[model samples]
Target: MGIRVGTRDDAEAIAEVHIASWRVGYAHVLPESVLYADDFEPRRRAIWSEWRFAPTQRVAVSVDDTDRVVGFAAYGPERERARGTTGRGELYAFYFHPDVWGNGAAAGLIDHVGERLRAEGFDEAVLWVLDDNPRARAFYERHGWHPTGIAADFDVHCELSVPEVEYHSPLTVEGRP
Candidate 1:
């Protein structure tokens, strides 16, 4: 088991894992067409291409011995209400293939992103999760994340504006979890 910084070259493997994650972990939540379609690769490629030029962003891709990404976390900058109070960086996405769940992959991903944010001048961090995903919500809570009750229009999967809950952590890496 190994993990390292991701690059543009990793887009293919990352896309496969991302789409697999959506299919297995979010099948009940995300729309069938979006999560199960053949367009996943193209959309993923577009996202990776855009991220390649975004400086200050971080991507920690967990891999097996074969360098296949099983999980990843990508985030940078504080925006919206996140920048209003905490004045810290915000998490754009934190996801892992459900096959790798409970295998220390998530903790490593969080630590990588959190450390990067701390070094990049963010004193706090926040992430949004679906309100009904109890497993993920519990995992965040275990890692010292708490809800800010700042719901948003996270209609990425659903036809309507799905209720998304915000989770925040003010402590730095040095702080207890």
Candidate 2:
């Protein structure tokens, strides 16, 4: 697997990963009607098409041997409302195609994103995950991200919402031995 910066041209592939991952990952936690909606792909594609990465924002994609995007991570300066100090970064979105779940692509993306965040001078970072998603929570725990106990209800759609918890990680300073 390889990791690199994502571009506008990758919007479709990124959307594919987003939908596939959500379909499998959130099957139990989220409503099937919303996940299987026909407009889901188009909506995601539209979002990716218009996404503008801020100067401090970084988007990374993990590709297979064929150079096809298999996973992606979008992060940037921590947004307001998250419980964190200054100089913090936020992992806005992360997803991988279900087919590549156990192939270490996810690990590579997390490490790459952490390095990018540290290089940007962020001392720490936070990400929101579904409170009931054991697989994702465990993955973050194994990756050194601990829950901050900050919980919120994430609106998945009109009249559909779920609980989420924030996970925090302190990015090692660059040049540290």
Steric clashes per prediction: 0, 0
Stretches of model 2 off by over 4 angstroms after superposition = 52-55, 82-86, 173-177
* TM-scores for every predicted model: 0.86, 0.93
Over the stretch 10-93, how does candidate 1's per-residue lDDT look in tens digits? 877777777777677776776777775676657876877776337767777888778778888777876676236646677777
Stretches off by above 4 angstroms in model 1 are: 81-86, 157-160, 173-177
Please, what is the whole-model Cα lDDT of each candidate in the order they appear?
0.75, 0.85
- Using lDDT, give the best candidate's number: 2
Q: Give lDDT: candidate 2, residue 145.
A: 91
